[model samples]
Every structure is written in C-alpha cells, then in structure tokens.
Target: MEKRKEILNELEELSPILFKIKAEGTDKNIVVPNGYFDSVENQFLDRRMQVENEIDIDIPTDYFDNIESAVFAKIKEREIEEESKTPKRKIINISRGRERVRLSFLPLLTKIAIAATLFFFFIKGTDYFKSNQSIEEIDYLASISKTEALNYIAANTHEFETEQLVGIEFTEEIKNVEEITSEELNSYLYENINELNEEDFSEIF
Candidate 1:
C-alpha cells in the first residue's frame, strides 16, 4: 500500500542518529543536514530524547503484548514473598485435658463396677438361704403304727412302672396313733369306691 510506504519513509526520516547517543544531549549539540526537513528532524529528536530520558526503565516486550497480565503477575509475586516471611499457624488438640482426666479415672470406674456386681450376687445368695430356712421339713409317717404304716405305704405305691414307693423309716421320737374304728373303714370303702384316689389309698389301712 502507498500509505504504508509513506509512513515507513516518514519514520526513516525522523531518526538519523539513533545509535549515535547513549547519554543525555540536546539536538543543538548534534549535526544535521541543511534543509527545511532538518529543522523538523531536530525538533522530533529533541522530543524523543526528552521522553526517553524521563523513563526510569526499559519496558519489556511482553508488557506491550498483555499489560494487565504483566501487572497481575507482579502483584502475585509480591504476595508470595510476603507470605513466605510470615510464621505458620500451629494446631493444638482441644480435648487433651478431658483425655487426661478420663485416663486417670478409668481404673477407679472399673473397680467400682466389679464391686457392685459382687455385692448384688452376695445379697441374692443370702436371700435364697434365708427363704430355704423357713420351709417345714416333712416327718416320716409319725401319725401311724408300724403295721398300719406298712400297709398304707404299700397301697399308695405308684402304679406307673417308672415310679415306685420304697421303704419308710421311723424316727427316734415316738408318735401316738389316732385310731379309727372298723365301722369307719367299712363305711369309707363302700361309699367312696368311685371317687377313690391314690392319696386316699395312702390312708385306707
């Protein structure tokens, strides 16, 4: 394009001694060719030098590509450096006091449980012994004579083959017999034959 070439030509004309000066200097101190264009070139170079001298740094290539990204990277680097200088936070176990107290009481609690269990069993055994002591023991046929006692036991013997009534023993203490008449025996057997039970046969003789 003609417009692009014109701009390039103008840029070339604007700078003739770009690498000639590395230090601060005015355009009047530099040489220029004799022409109307030389005056404009001198003014342009003066302005260029003034701007360059005011700058504190040489800008990086990437700064022109993405200015916001470059600034954000600089801010993040500063923050990382500040964090590295700060001390780390320490974590403390909150339950340590309760744990120590629990450990101290554990043995005492176990011993208490064991003692309570033993005391409950001992109380139950004593109650069982007291109850058994109150029960009356049955005496061996103390209300009947030797002949009558033998006959009564024989008659009341169980009829089941697995069950049998063995012998009886009289104690050292003597007992008085409550005698029944012959008429009473006859009336009892005649009237109660159908209603007779094994318990009744035990007293029939």
Candidate 2:
C-alpha cells in the first residue's frame, strides 16, 4: 500500500492529466468497425509475402503474462491519489505563425520550365535538320533501274492494276500459227486423255 501511494504521488508529479484520467475510470473495451480486420487481413498477408526473411524481435517470455496485472495495478494506485484531488479547467490557445511559408517547389518549377524549353528546341531543331537535309544526297527511288521496276511489278501483279498499267510498248503481237504433225497431235491426245471429256474429244476430233 505504501509503495502504491508513492508510485501515484510520483505519477501525479509527472502528469496531472494522467492522474485525473485515472480517477475517472474509462471503458476497457475497444470498438472496431465491422469487417475491418477481415478486409485488412488479406493485405497484411500479401505484405508478408514481400518480406523474404522472417524478422525476429527478442521479447521476454513472461512479458505478456504479467503486463495486464502490472497495468491494472498502476491504474489502481493512481486512482487512490486522484480521489482526493479536485479537477481544474484547462484553456488552450492555438494561433498561426506570423511569417508566411515560402513555396518549396520554386526550383523544381524553374528546372521543369528549362527542360520544356529545351525539349521544344530539340524538336524544332530535328525538324529543321530534316528540312535542310543535303539536296545532293542520292535519290534511291530515282536510281531504280527500269528492268527492276518492271520485274517487281510483274512479280506482284495482283498488287498493281497490271492490265490498265501496261501500254502498247509492253504488249507483243501473236506469232503465225505452226501446224502440228500427226505424231505430235497423238502425243498431246495421249497426255491429255483424262482432261478431255467425250464432248471436248468430239469437238477436237
């Protein structure tokens, strides 16, 4: 009892607010919002995965077992001392500082402006470089040989309007027909026997 009273007297000397709070007992139960722990449990679990190694803190084995009794005893000890004391109203005054705070990002803003100007200059310079390129530079498309262009067009005939594109110079007239000998006709018939049906064979014969 003497030790408890001494502890309360020491606590009152240290913090009167704590002393007053001890006299008026507060609710022990802590209220949490509905589903608060449920919602945050997954987040904590995810954060746990990011940590590669387990962090170990050295704790006394008997710390939790004795902590509740220790806290209760201290509060009880304060209460006895607080019952005899009368409460005083505390007045608090809050006011702003006299000097205005200077903007922190002025230097950053200056650097950004400089960067933006340089970026535009760089873009404009690039465009000027492209526009003022040497006129004497080799023209690859103009250097293309006529034969190569013609071959390219022929190879990719479907890609171009080939029939409409071709003119008199590119077209060739049919040569005079040459008569086939009897043996040649027989050879052609033998080769194409399956291809020609009775109607075609009749027309040919």
Candidate 3:
C-alpha cells in the first residue's frame, strides 16, 4: 500500500491531469463550471424529443392498402391502350399459277445438267480404266525375262495382230528364220499381207 502511494505521488508530481486521485478524506480539487451539466442535459433532452417526434409521424390510412391494386390497374390500362393502337395483320388470297408456270422449267433444266455431268464423268472414267489396264499389261510384259517373253510371243504369234508388233524389234538369236516352220511362216504372211505396206514387203523380200 505504501509502494502504491509513492508511485501515485510520483505520477501526480510528473502530471497532475494523468494521476487525478485525491488523498483519503480530502475532497476532489477539480471543479466543473457552474451550469455546464445543466446545459449538456438540456441539449440531450432536446435531441431526444426531436427524434421521438420524427418517429411518431403519420401517413394517410388507405395509401398502402390501395397502392398495389392502383399500380396493377394502371399497367393493365396501358396494355389495353397499346393493344388497341397496334395494327392487325390480314392475309389476302392470291393465285400462284403464273408464278409456278414461270419456274416450271427450272427442275427440268437442273435434271438435264445433272445427267450431262454424270455422262461426262462416266466417259472420263471409262477412258481412265482402259488406259490404266493397258499400262498394267505393258508393265507386266516388261517385268518378264527377255528370253521367256520372246518364246511366249513366238508361240502365240498367230494370236497377235501385225499392228500390235509394229514398233518391236526381234533379236537375231530369237529371230532365226530356220527355227520357224514353213506352214507357220506362210500362215503369218498370208494373214498380215493386207496390212503390209511397200516398205514392209520390201523388208520381208
């Protein structure tokens, strides 16, 4: 208790406003000015009365009760006026025979165009197939050994036309005239004689 009293005395010496406790049995030295509390109490009371008066304000009795119905009635009246002022559409019947006749040739022309396109593609496709087949045949023949190819051609000479062999040259080893029989030679010459020109005849002779 003595320690606390000493600390308080030190604080009071340093700052009187910070340590305001009075000594035991001694009245507080700080005093309020005359009428300060009276003026503050009167201001609080005036503000309280003003707030109470604001809270106790009044409004018309039926205003809220009819607000929703009045708003809805006004909206419905506006909708009705808009509907009355809007223009209505009327459908008129008319003949379409002339229009139909004018466009009648379109379908026929379209069909003809489609057919022509198909025909053109068909012709091109056929030619492509024929050319591809011929190329495959030539490749197959070229892949065979020359000896086997010559033997095969010699064996099947009657089956091939003269025009088919026009550009080909026979090697001397494969073209020995003595190896061909007289009957085969005669038959080949007789069959291709009509197609032979003077140059071919001169070479043969």
Highest lDDT model number: 3
Model 2 agreement with the true structure over 56-173: per-residue lDDT tens digits: 3444567557644543343344344433352332221212344221212322222222333333334453343244434221122243333433344334435533222221012111
Better of 1 and 2 by TM-score: 2
Q: For residues 93-177, what per-residue lDDT tens digits would candidate 1 score against the true structure?
A: 2133223111122222222222232333344533433343322211222332334333333333343111111112111111110
Q: What local lDDT score does residue 136 receive in model 3, on the 0 to 100 scale?
A: 24
- Name every residue pair that clashes in candidate 1: none
lDDT at residue 6 of model 2 (Cα atoms): 92
Judge candidate 1 at residue 30 and give its lDDT: 68
Better of 2 and 3 by lDDT: 3
Error of 3 at 2 (Å): 99
Model 1 CA deviation exceeding 4 Å by range: 1-37, 64-90, 93-205
Off by over 4 Å in 3: 1-141, 173-205
RMSD (Cα, Å) for all candidates, in order, is 47.5, 44.7, 43.6
Query: Superposing every Cα of model 2 onto the true structure, what RMSD results?
Result: 44.7
Residues forming the 10-long window of minimal summed lDDT in candidate 3: 100-109
lDDT of 3 by residue, 1-205 (tens): 4698798889899988667644442456668889888799888999999998897646556756764454334434544553466344222221243321111222222222233323333445434333333332223233343344434444454554432332123322123333433454446557646655665455334
